[model samples]
Target chain A: MNFKEALESGKFTVTAEVGPPKGTDITEMLHHIDLLKGKIDAANVTDNQSAVMRINSLSVCKIAMDKGLEPILQMTCRDRNRIGLQSDLLGASILGVHNVLCMTGDHTSAGDHKEAKTVYDIESVQLLNVVNNLNSGKDMMGNELKGPTSFYQGAVVTPEANPVEPQLMKFEKKVNAGANFFQTQAIYDIDKFKGFMDFARKFDVKVLAGFVVLKSAGMANFLNKFVPGITVPQELIDELKEAGKEKALDAGMNICARQIKQLKDEKICDGVHIMAIGMEDKVPEIMERAGLL
Target chain B: MIITKKKDPNNILETVKKYDKFFLIGCSECASLCGTGNEEALQEMTDFLESNGKKVTGQLVPKTGCQTLGTKIELKKDKEACADADAVIVMSCGAGTQSATEIFKDKPVYPSNDSLFLGNMTRFQMFDERCSLCGECVIGKTAGICPLTNCPKGLLVGPCGGMSDGKCEVSPDVPCAWVRIYERQKSLDNLDEMKEVLEPKDWSAGQKPGNLSTRSEKKEEKK
Candidate 1:
């Protein structure tokens, strides 16, 4: 089923992400698409994910479509201006790429190209509005379009944000801006994620808990230090450390599966969006362990 | 009020080296408080220009440098000296510099101070940005603090996860604006309003070269 249909059907949908490579070689990317096609309900194609230059998310979405997998195109405001964004939305609609994930993305400094000029002409909230406007058959300037898009608009939220008030405030804005669903930042603490969902449930939008599998202890520490809004608790880090060098990956997968299973059992959210950066092959295992299969 | 900082003496000198005689305009408002266009500052600049072998034909510390009509009326007394000057140097903000440019269309008008921001003077000569003039005010919702000015990212809804130790992620010394707002709102027992998520800003309202008439110039379209 398509992402919107799956979300509306409320069967605990599963979504994953696929980051397009920096160069023209799509062999490994295609393999990833094939691996994730049937395992997850929909796969998101990231647009130069860490502000790094890569194959366009639209192009990767097209590849995923060719592989018979539904693709959610992740668009960032850090790179494109309003005009570029509008044109890309129209293009995506024409190409039959329906799902969109709007974000104010990682800053340009986090990417490979440090000196690139960042264009935040409009951030995530405004971008969501633009998508809503387009879906309504009207442009940002209030001009009517000959054809309107039927995009399943989505946005990102950080449940574990230190000052959670602002994030909650923005979450409401996203709902007001016509977000159909939310795929959150990587979630480690389920109770905090549930707290975020308590607020989210007030709105008529789906919330998908983000699950990034912890490969090792060092990876968890790195995310805690560098990634904003993401906190890998000391206990989880300690657990991974105790798992020993050889079994850390397996322990990490188990932790991810447990969180997904808890989220599913508790009905805390509509579903989970698995983000296995370079390890797409292991997603089916995660889904199976979580009893999603 | 508009905040401004004076340009470097060497840079101003280099810019006006070709002109020997000049008229200096200073503002008695924000620029004066900022110490860029006060009477003492004008006198100091005049002495420096004279010491550097340049002529200060006349100088006027106008009540408000940005009020073009009032400045034009005030400059009537110094018309002869202003006419004799090769250029005009405005020691106020960019708006004041543009006023000089508007008044003296022929003479090259230059700004001696760089316009910083519209801010609150926290103390004597210490200015802190309080508003970004986004053309829409949400202070009532944000507990009288502007996220646009205080937050480095200017996030309408934030304190992005990057914040740590109650400080902003972008700038360590800066307290997270949203955090400050939350505290204030909590103290005031107004946390209920915090639930209201601010919608996307109507950016067209703050379009560049913003112009408006406070009252009617033409009749209203509808009653």
Candidate 2:
């Protein structure tokens, strides 16, 4: 099903990501795509995540399409100006890779590459507006596009930003800019995500509460420290610490599953994007435990 | 007019270091873009300097640095900072730079940033220098990356092995110019679009180690 149809289906849809390596070997990607075949409504391909600059996400989308798995591609404005962004939209539409998640992306500073100059021709809100303009067969600079594109464009939100008001304001702007749906930053507290959802429901936009299966206590703490707009409760940290090394992975997965179950049961979001990161192999297992499959 | 901002505390402290009697000159025009002479920026600079070191004698006057028509009137208004002070720092662009230098030839007048270009802010805090009055723009073909301004090595076809993973080898903290070009290509999915490498740039246009300026009338007359 197309992303929007899947959204309208109201089945408590599930989504996950499978990052393609920098090189051409797709064995690991194949394995993960196969694993998620029937489990998720869609699988997202990260585009040079963390600004490391790797193999393109479009190629990975082609591989996922071959594997009979739907793909939601992540596009960042850090690299492309308005022209490239519009052309890529058309190209992705032609490939039937319909779902897209737009992000301003992690700055070059956060990635392994510190000195990369950023392309701010269009920031996130402007990017959202460009997508809207492109869908209508035009580019940002008033040039008409060669063809039109019809794709379900999605953007991200951080539910845990210290001042939730600004995130909400951007959310409103993004929705106005033609973001049909959104996937939030990872949600560790069900109540917080729900409070965000209550605020979200006031708008006419669809939302998917983001969930990342924590790998270890260290990983959880690291995210809280480095990742902006993401905060994990100390209780979850203590839970991971209690599990110890051998069982930590399983415990992290369980906590993630419980969070997903709560989101699904409470019907707070239209879907969920489980960012397994390096833990893609265990995503299906976690989803099954969460009763999503 | 030559201009500079007193944003850096050390510079402000130095400017006002020994001057117990001072005049903080502010320009009402052109220098507004740099915000050096804008009331808030100037007032803040004045307050910070006074609290940190020297006692600043009050006098902030907006100037018409380029137009000599009001030179007498402006001097009457702001001559206090120039005459009574040990040094005079004009907060204006090159016009303000030269004008201040000419007015207070014996005193101190500094040019900040060499008056790079007319720029606008990105997200307010982050500034992006856009126009370089070079009378030439390659944004159409280069996809707006501005190799002239952005590329350190000025390589047309980039990401030479020097790019150890996106970051440039020339400076580890800096991203290789070619890496940015490659990324722009990837995002547009136009990897196969542009013909291989572009010819080396003709540095002839701006290679000089001297001043550069443009006059709108020259182009208007040419047309």
Name the best candidate (by lDDT): 1
Model 2 docking category: incorrect
TM-score of chain A of 1: 0.98
* Clashes per candidate, residues 3 or more apart or on different chains: 1, 14
10 residues in a row with least lDDT, candidate 1 chain A? A161-170
For candidate 2 chain A, which ten residues in a row score worst on lDDT?
A161-170
**Per-candidate DockQ versus the true complex?**
0.26, 0.03
Write out the backbone clash pairs for model 1: A229-B161
DockQ of model 2 vs. true complex: 0.03
TM-score of each: 0.80, 0.61
Candidate that scores best on TM-score: 1
Tens-place lDDT per residue, model 1, A1-293, is 67788899998999998989989998999999999997799999999988789999999999899888999999988788788999999999999999999987766767799788777667787889999899999988889999999899999888887767667777787898889999988999988877778888999999999989999999999998867688998999999999998999999999999999999998999999999999999999999999999
Task: State the lDDT of candidate 1 residue by residue for B72-142, as single tens digits.
Answer: 99999999999999999999999999999999989999898899999799999999888889889988888
